[model samples]
Target chain A: MIDVQLIGLLNATLQAATLLFIAALGELITEKSGILNLGVEGMISVGAVSGFITAINTENLFLAVIVGVLSASAFSSIHAFVTVVLKQDQTVSGLILTILGLSLSSLIGKPYVGKKLEVKLESLIDIEEPLNIFQVLLNQNLIFYIAILLMIFTAYVLKKTMFGRRIEAIGEDLKSADSMGLKIAKTQFIATCVGGAFAGLSGVYLTLSYVPYWTDGMTSGRGWIALALVIFGGWKPYRTAFGALLFGFLEALGPRLQTYGFEMSPYIVKITPYIITILVLVFLTIIKNGNTGAPKNIGIPFFRENR
Target chain B: MNKFILSKKLYRNELATFYSFLIGFLIALAVGSLILFIQEKNPFDVFSLMLKLSIGSVNSLSNSLNKAIPLILAGLGISIINSVKLWNIGAEGQIFMGAIALNFVYINTSINNSQIYIFLLLVSGFLGGAFCILFPAVAKVLFGVNEIITTLLTNYIVFGLTIYLINGAWKDPASLNFPAAAYVSESVYLPTVIGKLSSGFLICILFTLIAYYIKDKSVFGYEMRIAGGSALTAIYAGINAKQKAFFAMLIGGGFAGLAGAIELLSQTHRVSTGISQGFGYTAIIVAAITGMRPVGIFLVGCLFGALTIGGSVIQTIGVSSYIAEIIQATTLFGALIAQFFFSYEILKKSEND
Candidate 1:
């Protein structure tokens, strides 16, 4: 019984972590390209709504996911134009993007409230009885496997590719990068769009596989948590993936513990993830002496002539 | 052939912000109208009705003012912190903490004098807000942790605590099935200046005046400006940048808390999760569009409050109130674009060069 319960908890933790990891990976890319997009929450909401609507009308989960990703990417282009092209404050612009995305989602999503997705994203392998923990872990939806593969691919691209190096160079020192003839604006715009796409994927995963339903404001505070995860992981793909799992464990532990008849306020359990994030942030900042490998010019906008 | 060059303006344009707001307001109106048109409603009719319902009558105007009370106070708080180049994104959480603190004091004490009780609750609310932000401020100052993330994370934690209290310890026995604390005694209620308008409106004005004075005419304000402008310069000028940032954060938190306390004592009279309707978040926009000026905060707060009031009123006509948020966001974007132009003028490059 104990072993079975532990396996169940681990499975739940991985599932929860998949959502956070996907979103944070997108944010990691955006931040790595010298743009701070606080519109992740907004993007996720838009993606979820659009994806749900598509799924309801067409009953095609694959097409729904594509539409979700495309719409969110389009939405993020506004932030890209306002912040990157216009050279505005990233923080404020991102916040506005969030507000706009949220409101826009609600306005369009009004008709689809309380509607459920007809088809669900299914797992890759279906075994009636799992022989071990590995099987149990592998018995997740397609998005879960995609999340892992994406993490590995991202780690490889960021560490090995010239494109990744150019992104880092721009983020670290935009003036130097521009002097080196790097297309700062184009690279940052692409990076921001990529981030939006990942955020959309996370949203699609939530609606199609995780909850398999439609609800307003269902993304909740996960986007913000993903933002924190980027910092917590020091903007590294592997480290961020690990941090996502840690947060996922905390999120899953709350309900699992209650099911096991533990005596604690559910609300207190819910708050543990946030409290732990703060503690981890403080610990990391102290050990790193304020240099947590963040891109030096992460939030600053670049203008060629100004440089 | 000539290329456009962005040249920095030599003189500060004070009227630039005014013009920017006008442009932003018009942009927001256009967006709102477009959205309404898509919904098969007449944009002009909805807008005119919104204006009429929000400010046409004395009672409607009073309701708008009442709504503006919390917005002004919270906007003042945000402006204070923002002036110091710090982001106090936890204002929403701080507001809840203030309400919790006020309720704690009200429920525990047996103070008979209404004046004393109200004063004590107000102070407690301020302290509560300050206390909530203290951790994040200290973390930012001492450990060099990013306050933005820390402050935002605390919001979730505080919200959880509020839910815990209301559902468990503070749950009122008389109000069956409702997740809220019992109402306070009538003696502790804030006095009304007019129809449905609490004395909180006066408090907002008083706080705004004090903030304006501090920001425009005080030594601390000057030092704060220097510190926010450049920490290295501030150090050279014998100003403790860290200390200033800490105090500014606390003050910002206090403003949010006071808004909460006033909101509780004057409006709700009870503690519930629905006490704050994102006033803290909306106040950020209020501060942003106003350039963090105390006077601008007041004016923008009133405008947004009116928009919110009118937006809700139009819900009767099958229009979603989310239109208000959509408008507020577009206005911020428009103002941002306008600010870009105000600071940098486009110039034609000479062919000779």
Candidate 2:
């Protein structure tokens, strides 16, 4: 019985972590490129609604995911145009994007509220027999496995590739990178779009697999948590994945604790993750003494003439 | 062949903000009209009805003012912090915390004097908001932590606490199956001047005037401006930049808290999760559009308030109330583009010049 419960908890944690890691990793990429796109929530909303709508109409999971990703990327291009091309404030633009995304999603999604899609993504392995611990962990949806692979891919791209070096160079010092002939605006624009795509993917997973039904504002505050996770991870890919898992564990622990007859308000349990995020940030800041691994030009718009 | 280049202006254009806001407002209306047209609704008729419902009558205008009270206060709070180059994105949470604190004090105390009870609630509300931001302010000053994330994270925590209290402890006993607190005594309720317009409007205006004076004509404001512009320059000028920033954050939080308190006493008179309808977030746009000028915040807040009221009214015609938010968001974008144009002039020049 204990073994089964433990496995169940672990599976839940992994599911939650998958969502966070995908979104945070995307945000991590954008921040690394020195473009702070705070519209993760907005992108996620657009992705979720569009993906859910497409899934219901076509009943094809693959096409739905593609549509979701493409829609979110298109939505994020607005941020790129406003902040990168026009050189406006990234923070304000991102916030507006969030407002626009949420409102627009609700407007578009009003007709589909409470609607469920018949088609669902199946697990990678469908073993019916009593499974071992390894099998229990491995028997997850295709998106779960995809999330892991994406993490690895992101780590390699950011660490090993020449393009990765250029992104970091642009993030660290815009003038120096521009002098080096790096296409600052184009790189940032692409990075922002990629981040939006990831956010959309995470949202698609939420509606398609996690909930399997359409609900207004279903992404809740996960996008914000993912944003914090990037900071908690110190802007590193592997560290971000680890942070996502830890948060997932905390999120999963609350309901499990209640089932085990623990007398605790669910709200208090819900509040734990946010409190821990702040505490961890404080601890990280104190120990590192201000080297939080943030890109120096993270929020500043790159202007070639000014440089 | 001729090309255009952006040349930075030598002096700041004072009328840029005015023109930018005008352009932004017009652009938002255009976008809203397009959406309405797409929905097969007559844009002109819908817009005229929206304006009529929101501000056509004195009573509706007063209703808009009542709604604008908290917005004005919250905008003032955000403007204060922005002046010091700090972001207090947690104003939403701070508003909730302030309400919680005010309600807690009201429940615990046995004070019967209406004036004292009101004053105490106001003070507690301010303190609660200040407390909400205290951690982020200290973290930013001491450890150089990014206050934006910290402040934002706290909002969720406060929201969770609000839900817990509403469901568990503060749930009204007399009201069956409802998750809300008991209403405060009627005596302590803020007196309404005209229609639903409470004395809270007066309080908001007073604070706005005070903030304007402090920001423009005070020595502390001068220090804050210098500190925000450049820490090294502030240090050279014998100013404690960190301290100024810290105080600015606290004052900002205090204004949000005061807004919460006024909201409670004047509007709801009971604690619930729906007390703040994104007033804090909307205030950020208000402050940004007005460049943090207290008077401008007041004007913009009332305009947004009218939009919100108009949005709800249009629902009778089968339009989604989300139209208000859509317009608000677009307005920000429009203002951004206008500001860009105002700051950088596009000059036509010969390629070989």
Top model number, TM-score:
1
Query: Per-residue lDDT of B226-281 in model 1, one digit per residue for the tens?
Result: 98899899999999999988999999999999999999998889888877887888
Superposed by TM-score, candidate 1 places the C-alpha of residue B135 at a distance from the truth, in angstroms, of 1.2
- Count of clashes, each model: 0, 0
lDDT of 2 by residue, A1-307 (tens): 4376777888788888998889999999999999998889889999999999999999999999999989998999999998998888998888778878988999889889988689987677875632466776668888898898999998999889998988899999999998898989899999999999999999899889888887777877788889889988999999999999999998778778977789888789888878887888898889988888899999998875621
**Tens-place lDDT digits, model 1, residues A1-307:** 3377787788888888999999999999999999999999899888888998899899998999999989998999888988887888899888778778888898899988887777888788986655577887778888898898999998888879999999999999998998898989999999999999999999888888878877767787788899989998999999999999999998889877777888898889888888988998899899999989999998898865631
User: In DockQ terms, which candidate is top?
Assistant: 1
Question: What interface root-mean-square deviation (Å) does model 2 yield?
Answer: 1.6
- In the range B1-353, model 2's lDDT, one tens digit per residue, is 32666677667689888788989989999999999899999999998998999999988888888888878888898888988888888888888888999999999997878898899999999998999999999999999888878888888898889889988799898856767788988988989888767888998889999899878888999899999999899989999999999999999998998888888898888888877988888888888888888999998999999998899889999998988888988888898899888777767776557
